[model samples]
Target: MKSCYLTRPGLLCALGADTDTVAEALFAGQQQGLVLEQGWLAHDHNAAVRVGRVAATLPILPPAWQARASRNNRLLLAAVQQIMQEVERCKQRYPAHRIGVVLGTSTSGVDHAEWALEAHAAQGQLPEGFQFEQIDLGDPARFLADWLELTGPAYCISTACTSGSKALVSARNLVQSGMCDAVITGGVDTLCRLTLNGFTALESTTSELTNPLSLNRAGINIGEGAAVFILSAEPGAVQLLGAGESSDAYHISAPEPEGLGASAAMQAALRDAGLDETSIGYLNLHATATIKNDAMESKAVDRVFPHGVPVSGTKGMTGHALGAAGALEAAFCYLSLTDTQGRLPPHCWDGVADPALPALPLVQVGQQWRPGPRYAMSNSFAFGGNNLSLILGGGA
Candidate 1:
């Protein structure tokens, strides 16, 4: 297979609004962006929940693109703005049709729809600027394609949490298949009422800082942000080495007990990368802090790396970005792979580990890995048992 190089990545989340800011905060194990706030739940205005919200001022979309305007798209625009130089470089080197766009998102403009509905009920008409296309799942990709003027394959993936990582996998295929020479890929999600309330109904949201892999672990904290990358055939600082995907469909909302499906995805990624357990220097786990998820993932990691590998669950800091979680965590691994000091992202959780789970080597603050070609794996298991594992390697 032709190799796909992951060029400069643009990411913004609860950590910060750019790669450097987020990386600095990530290595420092900072959770300053995650704050307690209320008003997300319509039925309960007094309920304050800890959430990973982007505190930075976002760029506004031009009036020409007003129809596509939404917080979800704005977050995506914020990320893309960071990579404009590289994107322009690609435009100079390739035809418009040779550049593709593939993004993953869940709550695309749903918040706008919520507002429109409220206005309609109060005023007997849809909001003056509301458009049905804003709520479409494909809007993010469409907005990006029009913004960049790229005529290649542009689309969105919406398999719950795995959407973002799956976009990377699919973008790699497009490049390797010669469908495009370069593709803008990654994920973006915004805070919205539908998702917050939906997960609340499922009893999957936590009001406190999410405590993943801890005895007191309760549930996840919903977050919003975006991570965009330029994926090309040209070699770059980081490379997308391999990817594995599987859909076990074990449950609609819960992962398979014992992690049979999760293990399959991880093992497949290793096989795809032509590496074994010891080759991975670090792992960014899909630790949502939910009871069943943490338990199942523990077994899966233990099964794949019986000898133990350095691992960390980062949801405590970024909250879960839902469809963007996979890509956001993958971006964390990308940042780790490129760190000159070999600083591994610390697991942002209370110092407590559940004794019942396997004794995985969770990374601590100031943790550093050995010098050499660094390889890391990021896991994303979504609803309905959709799972994906991505292997990224940097250095010689």
Candidate 2:
């Protein structure tokens, strides 16, 4: 495969509305964005749950794009707006058809549908603005393609939590296969009753702050946000060094307990990057704070990095963004690569560590990576034993 670079990035998440604000908040270990809120449950009687949300006001879609209006697209728009200039530059450098849009999303616009359904149950008709296209899984990509007037390949990947990471992988393939000169990639997802209620039914949520790798760790706090990256043949400061994916299909909703599949993904990424395990300086763990996820990930990480590498689970501050979590965490790694201070995202959790799991070197608030070539690995594992690992290298 040819070298594929991540030229520019735009991010909106619980950490902050843009990449700079988010990078500052992430390095400081700020948890103010994660808050306990109510009104997400199926029944009004359910208690409030902690969730990471974007407090910033998102831009509204223009009247011309009303058919694709929804909170989900609004988040994606906020991110894309940050890089609009760069995206336009790409259009000038390459033909419109050579620029593609590929994104990942789990709840495209279902929140809007949920509200429309409520009104239908009581009013006997769908709301005036309600459109069936709002809830389509492919709406995000379609909306971007239309908004940017790009005729290249545009699509969405919806493989549970691996959606975002898989989108990045697909974008790289497009560039390497000579199908596109540049690709708009990453993912976006918004908080909604449907997503929260689904996790609640699966017993994968907690009322308190998420605590990863802690003895008293309970469950994950849901979050909403989006991260957008411009990938192309253009040389840039940061590059997508390697990508690996695996699916064990061990169970419908549980990871392979021993992490056999997870380890395979990491190993494959290392091989793809043409670097050994020791080359990685920091690792962004897929720490959802769930017992099974943490346990399985711990074993998988240990198997891949026996000598141990600095690792931290960022969900303590950003909450799992479901399908968008992969891109969100990758944004964290990208921020770290650009930081001159060599700062790493700290592990936020109780002081107590689980004795049953292997001991891993969790990052501290002021900890920094060694001075040299900076390579960070991020892992994302989803339902059905689907797993992905991405390696980002730069800031040498």
Candidate 3:
């Protein structure tokens, strides 16, 4: 398989609007990015739950693309703006048809639909600006293709939380199949009334900052953001070495109790990367902080890296961005792999650790890994047992 090089990544989440800002804040232990607020859902005005909402103003869309306007797309636009210069260079470097686009998203314009319904209920008519296609799972991809004016393959993945990570796999396939020379891939998700209320109904919404692998852990603090990457055949500081995907179909919302599915994904990733467990320099865990998820993931991590390796869950700093999480965490891995500072992102949680879970080597603040060709692994597991793991680094 061809090594997929992540030439550049653009990410915006609760932590900050760019990679450098987010990295500084993450290692600096600045947890003010996530805030507790109310009125996220229309009916639940008083629910002041902790959430990681991006505090940046998104770029406005052209009037021609107004119909496709939505917060999800806006967030994507913000991320794209960061890499526009590099992307334009790619446009000049590759064939127009050889550049593709693939994005992952769970909520796309549902927020607009929710408001349109409210306007309809109050005024008894659909709003003039609301377009049905804006709610499409693929609109983000379409918008990007048009914005970039490229004719390459474009699509979106919506496999719940695993959607983002799987997008990297899909983009890699496109390039490996000789369909494209380069692909812009990543994920974006916006907070909407539907998702907020649905999670609340499922009792997965947390009221405080989540404590992953902690006894007092409640549930996840839902967040919103976008992450975009310019992937190409040309090598860079960080390369996408391997990606493993599996669907265990364990449950609708709950992961398999024993973490067989999660373990399979991790093991597959290590095998795909042509590396053993000890080769990975750092691990970006998909620690959602939910009791069952933390427990299951712990077992899976313990099974895969028995000898131990540095691990950390960045969700505490950015909250859980859900569909965009995989890409966001992948960015964290990409940063660590290429970072000259050799700083590993610390586990951003309370010091209290849960004794029931396996004792993994979680990184502490200001910790640095050994020097070498850095390899970092990131994991993303979602509903319906959709699991994905990507290994990023210079190959051994």
Q: How large is the C-alpha RMSD of every model relative to the true structure? A: 1.0, 0.9, 1.4
Answer with 2 or 3, whichever has the higher lDDT. Answer: 2
Question: How do the residues 1-396 of candidate 2 rate in per-residue lDDT, one tens digit apiece?
Answer: 679898658998899999899999999988889998877887764578889999999997779888788999989999999999999899999998999899989999999999999999999999897899989999999999888899999999998899999999999999999999999999999999988988989899998889999989999899999999999989898899998889999999999999999999999999999999999999999999999999989999999999999999999999999889999888899888888888999999987999999899999998998878999999999999999999999963
lDDT of each: 0.91, 0.92, 0.87
C-alpha lDDT of residue 91 in model 2? 91
Clashing pairs in 3: none
TM-score to true structure, per model:
0.98, 0.99, 0.97
Q: Top lDDT: which candidate number?
A: 2
Positional deviation of 373 in candidate 1, in angstroms?
2.3
State residue 156's C-alpha deviation in candidate 1, in Å. Answer: 0.4
Off by over 4 Å in 1: none
TM-score of 1: 0.98
